[model samples]
Target: MVFKKFTNGCVNLVNKYLPDAFLFAIVLTIIVFLAGMGITQQTPMAMVKHWGTGFWSLLSFSMQMVLVLVLGTAMAKAPVFERLLTAIAMSAKTPGRAVVITAVVATVACWLNWGFGLIIGVLIAKEMAKRVKGVDYRLLIATGYAGMIVWHGGISGSIPLQIASGSAESLAQQTAGALTAQVPTSETIFAPFNLIICLLFLIFLPLVAHAMMPTKENTVTVDPRIFEEPPAPPAHKFTPAENFERNRVMWIITLALGYIYIVYNLVTTNFNLGLNIVNMIFLFVGLTLHGNLRRYIDALMASASTAGGIILQFPFYAGIMGMMTGVSAATGTSLAQVISNAFVSIATPVTFPLFTYLSAGIVNLFVPSGGGQWAVQGPIMMPAGVALGVKPAVTAMGIAWGDAWTNMIQPFWALPALGIAGLSARDIMGYCVIVLIMGGIITSAVFLLFGGMGWF
Candidate 1:
């Protein structure tokens, strides 16, 4: 009861202060601008230039993220996907059970693929909210978002995969020759320490979610009516164009081509599953499962609205990344480098991973994309850790875990889930802040205890 009260208070406080996500991005931009000037040698105009230059940096990444949410939501709207999600959601008999189950499912899903997990988690929460009366819809969604806490330690984690698959020449260049060879998954994602952290999150997060549930009077349930699928348009005799839209022949040919390339790529490239491939798989699978171009188009149109926040907000974050990584003429260091360097300066061989984890979490606030964050911090931290006697894998995973850790409060990654749940960042972030604190403790402790020991 005391814990619930505390959780409620946290939620209330966030609800009071956290603005709309777009506004939050603006606020962060202002903070980064001010901090850049105050800490670095850059003039105000230079800071603005940095922001402007960086604003468009994520255009390619922005599109990919858009599709991650859009396609995932579209796929979820397909009858088969909807039925599967409903069945899973129906397993939760009570409000408390609903939050617990959503948390577990989201965590597991995130472990497999963060993008896949993000959509699945919130979709499941939305489904549960429809069926499970009295469930706190905000808490349910937040529980889903909490699953991201383990993402960097998961199988599809970018940092782990990057180090494990990076070409020796490219990695050597990125890490300043500190990492000339690939760091296998066994040394990072599947490492004992990393596994322990993922397992702990999988175990305790559901309990945390259960404890955070608001009381009956305070619980904010979703209106199931809001989720009702719209009726399809009336059938009509078709012209050639219309027939093409509705026909399975075209879709079959498209799917065949897509699957053929997918198989060829898997066989030839040793199953390299990057973001583009993930999006392609989602696109083809969604198209196949929906059974016709018209139905898939309808589903895509229905889910397209959810991409608004991502479209509106990501560039500002890209600019924030710009400010964070833009080097100051006077100090010769970017804000991100300054932050990373501070942690490195304090680290010994034993504490390197812990410090790296801590620093990455901090940097992630400004640059939320895992790949972007790595581009900024990896070059700096990797070599530093290697010099301190820490294994390259340990250092890399520290950065990975760090990037994933603070995502709880970072609204960037939450956009997709927020869009799916029809909630603002403020609505769920309060609970996520709670998850952030506890998860930080869990990951920090794991890194401190065993991160430097090199399980590989």
Candidate 2:
């Protein structure tokens, strides 16, 4: 079909032109640094210093992201995980169905918990790649990530949940109360308008991806050898040390400890499903299913390659984040301030939600974290929303989706899925660009429709 040809053409073009993830990060770093120099009065040396100070700023976050890829890949290697994934993959009778199923399952899982959704999406899509003959490896991964595109609309959506739980102290402090105190989940995450937008993406993204499957002759399937499982660690003549390494009791004990911790947190604190907790869950799940220390270590080694791009490049992005969003020790003007102020100047009261969404999308390129981005943009956009007579909750959701929308192209979020799938951003970003365009249309239409209804 013409559609398939166009999509395939796009893919080939990307494969020809797109660079590796590390280079992509470097290029983004250069661009942001230049922008910082142009937009702010900071000296080049000062900007470089800021970049240096900020390079390690994302260490904790980098570790969290690394774990998601590392542990998630290790978890997928377990015999139990692989079997479960294979069983589900087996249900898909054709290549297109595999892509569709992965997308739907990923979207729904992401709706419940973003981390769970993330790991599950990549794991399942990898399974499908291993099991489904002739599935385009890149398209399968793209479909999995497409499911993640809906995470901002899900229960774990950071900005909406923050506003819903009335814990937006950071925003309030920054904005001096330009944002209201609390706008319940009813007006944000669970809003009927938001739900309609979420539903459309959840249903349509997979179908669109399915439709984009390349012609039979042009389909690009990866070699099965790439996903082959590693051999279980060999046992020599019986010894106490070997027995200790091979025993399941230690694994079970460790698993029990993790479960106890999870229970204690859920009961005494709250359902703390942040990246750390989720990473812990992935760790324990990997350990338990892997069955023993030696086997787990082997599985870990097998998937360790997946984390290289993420590990090498996160610091550069952190540096870029520093220059663009961090206040200069001298000049004081941030690139984020300039870009956001420009948008703020042009936005009308009634049209601000759409601007909020678009502006968030722009800032999201430099600042990828949902909470971090909200902190930077919320103060400015939220106050403006109120002045323009926009609903606080709607303003909040608009920013949320904007953050999610740009994620499709940002290599930051794609690291985990790529690590799992053994693909680079260049392999799938072309397809993701298509998804991003579609997502923008859907998000823009929803924002406009509600804006017209005076639902601001």
Candidate 3:
């Protein structure tokens, strides 16, 4: 009862104080800018230049993120996809069951692909909201976002995937030759400790979220009318172009041709999965399931509006990444590097991973990009860990968890899920604060125990 009171208090506080996500980004930008000037003593103009350089840097990445939402939402709109999701949602006959089921499914989906996980969670939540009475809609969306806390430990994780396949040269250069060889997936993603962590979250996060559900009087269920499905397009006689647009056979043939390359690449690349490949899978699956070009295009258009927040917000984050990592000519170190080095300076072997996790979580607030954070911290922490007798994979996983850990409170990544669920970040972030605290304790304990046991 006391714990529930504390959780409810957090929700009320965030709802009172949390601004819109875009404003949060702006405030964060100001904080980083001022911090950079104070910490590095770099001139404001120099910082502005760095910010401007990075403002457009995420154009490609931003598009990929946009497509993750657009494609996943589109795919979910297909009749088959709707039926499958509805069947899964129907199992949750009660409010607690709805929350638990959403968290578990979202966790597994996020493990496969973070982008897909984000959309699927809310879509399932929406379905459950329609069928289940007394489920808190805000908490359901928050549960969807909470699933992302395990993504960095999963198959599609960027840091592990980068090291396993392509970042060796860059990593070597960044670490100043202290590390050279690639760290394989066997040592990172599929490693015993990482798998154990993923399994625990898969088991426990749902329970934690189930416990956080508001009471019947406090619950905020969504209006079912908000999720009314769009009507099917009317049939008509067609011109040549129109006939091509409606042709299912043409789409199937094209999908078949795309899959050949996809299969060939997976075979050649030893089944390595990357963000681009995940997007391709979403695209092909969405196209095939929607049955024809016209309907698929319609699905895509319907889902496109959900991407506005992501589109408007990511470049600012990219610029924030730039400011966080950009070096000062006077100080000769970036703010991110300085923040990392502070934690590294006080570390013993057992505490190295713990401090690294804590520091990564802090740095993640300012530089939320996993790849970007790794670029800044990986080179610094990995080398320091090696000198202290910790393994490279352990150090890398610490950084990965740090990136995923703090995301429970960060509204940037929550944009997609929030947009789909028709809720503001403030509506859901209180439950996420509980998730952030619970997840922090879990991951930190794991790192400490394993670090002490020399289990890594």
Candidate 4:
């Protein structure tokens, strides 16, 4: 009873103060520590390996934090681009149209990077909300939160691509070729198709939702003044000539592209310059470009400050992943047998993806990290998929679709969006429930169709 009370108290405290990532970390740590204690008595070597894996996983996450911060800061400071985005968002005619536009914008933002997508999606939704009247806060929240779903399908998602290509290393090997083939293909095909589908759903969804709840009215209005004030031209701190002389943006872009090129080359060529050496190069370039030595010190400190939460949380996630992986490995065959048995009971081919989707959704509630879930589920599903004569990629897509669709209602990723928009998850769940249902159907159908065509 006392332990239960203590746990509950901790949960309430975390819910009040920390972000979901941090909260997840805290809970994960407690669970891992207890589990480790139990397992160490029987398998010390396995326990050691798990801890080691957790440590490396934490380091990888820290590196990801550094990358996210750099990209986020640069994007935020690019006033010209930000204003352009705002103008485009404000151009939508109705509140419903604005919501649809927000979804498309969110999808595009996620294509760049998940962190950028989440941040910018919130900003766009907030901008739209301010201009729109009688707007359902739920609708705004839905639009903002839906951005997370698109992240897995986006160009930079890495999760699905990693699974599709076998692993991160393999994906990196054919980076240039894959970039040439996949990027353009994604742009020409999936991107426009996704946009049109989202728009169509947006148009039809409210009508269906209205039918279900007949008493509720579609009550969203737009203010003319919101669109009347054209944004002032960006203040160029440097004149055109001065800007040309400074060349800060150009330098940054060049450095970024150079880093990507080097990384791609090293991976593709199977060269071993060492990841640490590459990181050092990035650190040196970032420090030098941000400013002189003194300013570099300031930048590092600022970056470190923002990275603290992520740094702490990542290890806990690693530990949880370690535990999950350990469990799966120990009972993998038995689990696979059970899943296979269940599969036999299902009636149709559609049942396979549907089952995987539902399982993914359930697991996502507990393990919101896409990479972590993939690590746990990939091995289990891949073998089953092979045995069943289903392409592994199709199974992977099923996982991704399920993971993405439920993110609409999951508070894990919603916290940041909520903070930025100044709304609770509850405020959003009302409308998002509709989107979730529609998205689920659409995603399942897409997977099934692609699976049949071997496109997945």
Please give each candidate's TM-score. 0.97, 0.94, 0.97, 0.59
Worst 10 residues of 2 by lDDT: 227-236
The residue pairs that clash in candidate 4, if any, are: none
Q: Rate the local accuracy (lDDT) of all candidates.
A: 0.89, 0.83, 0.89, 0.53
Mind sharing the TM-score for model 2?
0.94
Better-scoring candidate (lDDT), 2 or 3: 3
The sequence of per-residue lDDT tens digits that candidate 4 reaches over residues 1-456 is 453344234334543654445664566555554555453332556655665575556567556545554444333324454476568766866666666667767756665456667767766776676655555444655665666666666544545455334444553333311221222324322444344444544455444332322112534333535424246468667677655645656556656676777777668844333334334444545544554333344444543444444455556556555544443345333222233235434624445666666666655654567776665555555455555665444555556656677776566566555544545555555455556766777766655665466543
Residues 116-142, candidate 3, lDDT per residue (tens digit)?
A: 787888888888888888889898889
Residue runs of model 1 more than 4 Å from their true location after superposition: 451-456
- Report the lDDT tens digits of candidate 1 across residue range 1-456: 888888988999999998999999999999999999998878999999999999998999989999999999888888998899989988989998999999999999999888888888998989999999999989888998889888888988998898888899989888878888988898888888889999999999999998888888998886899899777679777899988898888888989999999888878866766788888889989998899998899889888998999999999999999999999999899999999999999899888888999899999999998999889998999999878888888889889988998899999999988888888999999999889989989988887777455442
Native RMSD of candidate 1 (Å): 1.5
What's model 1's overall lDDT?
Answer: 0.89
Counting only residues 3 or more apart in sequence or on different chains, how many pairs clash (N, Cα, C under 3 Å) in candidate 2? 1
Of candidate 1, the 10-residue stretch with the lowest lDDT total is: 447-456
State the displacement of the C-alpha of residue 109, model 2, in Å, after optimal TM-score superposition: 1.8
Off by over 4 Å in 4: 1-56, 62-70, 111-116, 130-138, 157-160, 163-312, 328-350, 412-434, 445-456
